[model samples]
Target: MASVTSAESGRLGTLPLGYYSCSEPGDAGGQAWIDLPDKHFTIGNGSTYHTDAGSGTYLLTGKRVIFTRGPMKGVRFERSGKVTLRWIDEDGKPGRVRCVRQASSV
Candidate 1:
């Protein structure tokens, strides 16, 4: 197995580091939020991503992203556009959840 460094991982995929607004069926007002900061990943409702403690690590490969650890572990998403990601259901089809980049961060 080959090992990937932090610098290498950042260059492996196109997901940008920032806040994202996610919408899905059944969600309140059909909205949620996620934050991608370097190697850390956080998901929360409204704008609570900054305070949420359920954050975990993520892995990006090609056009797919997988929540590798934490509360969101096992969740997978596929890039649908320049700044959009769609959830991948267990059946491997795009689910109702769609996330778009809301803001960029350093």
Candidate 2:
């Protein structure tokens, strides 16, 4: 496995998948607070993706995000931000991200 480095500086609060999300639904409590306290913004649904990397399927959800991944490399992610999937040139590492409540994809 490769070392997972920070894609950017100041990008904080990393967590494992089940820390907040429930892929099977119903089990999802309001722990959505995982994506709280974000700055203003919108998302690009055109770029949202949901790939299976074995560890878990990450959901982008169309907004600013903070993600926690597995201890392995060559992983994949999913987009669940729900906005227009228009992914900007991610200055941050293309890891996990959560969107704020402004109807935007971070």
Candidate 3:
């Protein structure tokens, strides 16, 4: 496989290079101060992403983002907005977890 530099990631990858937070809704009963469990990720160039668990390569095909390697291999998501991604289950159903782009990159 070819290596991709951080600067080249922007031109090679479909998604914007930056930090992202993936979260699932918490059962806080609508409490504002309650925090939802979130996972941090770095969307890097060359269709790559990194999390606390591991790093992975992804493929952006139209609106779908599919993980091709590493810990998240085989996981898939669909682009919900410019800065958001919604998980897609095996049955093609949208999942509760959502990943939102942050203001910075690694």
Maximum-TM-score candidate: 3
Task: Extract clashing residue pairs from model 1.
Answer: none
Ranked candidates, highest TM-score first: 3, 1, 2
Candidate 1 at residue 27, lDDT? 41
Work out candidate 3's RMSD over C-alphas.
7.7
C-alpha RMSD for every candidate: 8.6, 14.8, 7.7
Residue-level lDDT tens digits of model 3 in 4-91: 5442233223788898777777666774323233456788878888877889899876677878998788888888788998889889
User: Each model's TM-score, in the order given?
Assistant: 0.61, 0.19, 0.75
Candidate 1 structure lDDT: 0.62
Worst 10 residues of 2 by lDDT: 16-25
lDDT of every predicted structure (CA atoms): 0.62, 0.29, 0.76
Report the C-alpha lDDT of model 1 over 16-72, residue by residue, as the tens digit: 667666666454564354333432333333212331446666667767777777666
lDDT of 1 at 5: 48
When sorted by lDDT, best at the front, the candidate numbers are 3, 1, 2
Off by over 4 Å in 2: 1-50, 57-62, 71-81, 88-106
Candidate 1: lDDT of 64? 74
